[model samples]
Target: MILKRFFQRSQSPARSCYEAIVAAARHPRLYADWGVPDTLDGRFDMITLHTYLVLERLKGEEPEFRQAVVDEFFRDMDRSLREMGVGDLSVGKKVRKMAESFYGRIAAYDAALAAPGDGLAAALARNVFPDEEGGPDIAGVRRLAEFVLTQRARLAAQPVRAIAGGDVRFEEPGP
Candidate 1:
């Protein structure tokens, strides 16, 4: 239900892009941590507007806006990454990796939806559009979000241990 709620709040074109960026940043396994900026005003506003345009096109309402929004989104992402002190090489690599992974997942989900089944395929399909019949399934999305969040939480809660050779050394627990 939490994922459903999160997505519900995220479905607003005005907010979904920001939420997506936040979600990506929060992913525990991410390789970099640029830390939060002092303010999210301009960047957030740009992302929201760009995302809204993308959503409008996806919904077949304003198809012409997609390319412009996409261009603006990349420009904003690059600027934000630089402002956060992410090195040029690192930013480019990370962004490309993220984009590839994101697009791959989306494509896979779309393919799954085109198939005829009601199991994992159905679940994957649901992720692409979590609000329509045979489309997005809130319950499924919630399950996935919870699973990812739990993994992230576990990673965060883990104590840092030193590994030497083949062995790990951990600090003693407090009495």
Candidate 2:
């Protein structure tokens, strides 16, 4: 049973998609040029944002495929918490909180993207930049918002077959 599960995980398309999402979220330019914080919360927000974009694009593709990807994301979060020395008993609670945060972010981004004007940028500022001494970096927040919109369009252009085949690409972020 254990080996079967391991092999399935290794071979899953969902795994590949999750990896691509993580790679995109971890792009150095996001932190350096776009001004996303390099801290744990910042990284989490980035990953969550990227995941939302992919999952949004995956709509109507296949319910199972989306569920698999979501499962992989939660599994990674659980693993990360464990590695960070979170107690096993506490892991579930933290993962739950993470889920709540993820869903809230998804809702925020969805609403913002669907709205006109500076909604998206405002959401990005609130979530990506969070609290700052004077205020969040407006230029950086705008840049990041632009990057997110561009990625959304790029993902939309990708063939569903290609995405289902575990092949996905994200354009590099720039200064």
Candidate 3:
């Protein structure tokens, strides 16, 4: 079993892409300079956003590959919940809810991206900073929106072959 796990870990491009997504999401500037709350939900939102960007870029790729990447995401989420000491009985339910949240974010973000003006920023503010009183920090959310737009274009310009080979690259988020 250990050897099998090792082999899969070493061979999976999906794994590499998932890792890249997590690394990008964990960039400290996102939480510190960009005003994303340094909390579990905030982190999840960031990861979801990055995942959407990659998936969007992968739209015309093999269906199996896309599904594999998504499977990797859910597996990681399951592991995260387990590590957080969530009871086994509750983990599935929580993951289901998370999946719902992810899909919802994807839909919102996708539509907002095509919307005119501050639509994307508004969506990010609503989803990423949901806990903020009155409203999420508009300026911070706008900054994040700009980052997302830039990354989306960058991802689009990247060769699909490289991304399919798990060579995804994301620019550092900065102030």
Candidate 4:
């Protein structure tokens, strides 16, 4: 009871937003037949993409809340690593690497979104299909990029209270 109260009291407003992002990213349709590899890196990339969207949505809000969400994200990453049997020391290093990778992704994705033409697809192909044998699936990259743009617009339209309360929802990879 004491522990529950302690945790409940400390919960961030962005907790639900994070949970919503993870839930959508983990949707089986993203992997089962969508061409996303069912491997660890694939999963990480998807999660990072979704999380980055949420962070971008938070950009116009209080800086502290955005930082809180980011901090909470790393905490969740640390917990996930431990749950997956990573040793404590290695977990820190791995999470550090993940953070660096995510920041890089953020820059690439932001640039792609800002640039003209098929830059978003190109960025997705490079990041999400980095290990594909013949090369990235152009169709799949295009579809994923479409979804990102759609979802970003939807996220931006959501009331801040709804997002903060974790009631966010996303359309699938199509209209």
Residue-level lDDT of model 3, residues 52-93, one tens digit each, is 999988887867777888899999999999999999999999
lDDT of each: 0.40, 0.90, 0.91, 0.82
User: Over the stretch 66-133, how does candidate 4's per-residue lDDT look in tens digits?
Assistant: 67667777888899999999997899799989999889999999899889999999989999889999
Could you estimate the TM-score for every candidate? 0.35, 0.93, 0.93, 0.89
* Clashes by residue pair, model 1: 129-136, 130-136
1 or 2, which is superior by TM-score? Answer: 2
Q: Write the per-residue lDDT of candidate 1 for residues 1-175, one digit (tens) a residue.
A: 7677766632333233344434433333221221112134323422332243233224443343344335445665677789989998899886686456445554544444356554333443333333445544445444433433343344334332211011111121111
Error of 2 at 121 (Å): 0.5
TM-score of 3: 0.93
Write down the TM-score for model 2: 0.93
Residue ranges of candidate 1 with Cα displaced over 4 Å: 1-63, 118-175
- The superposed Cα distance between candidate 2 and the true structure at residue 74, in angstroms, equals 0.5
lDDT (Cα, tens digit) per residue for candidate 2, span 1-175: 8788877745689889999999999999889877789999999999999999888998888678888888999999999999999999999999999999999999999999888999999998888888777878899988888898899999999998888778888888877
Q: Which stretches of candidate 2 lie over 4 Å from their true place?
A: 1-10
lDDT of 4 at 164: 64
Cα miss at 146, model 4 (Å)? Answer: 0.6
lDDT for model 1 comes to 0.40
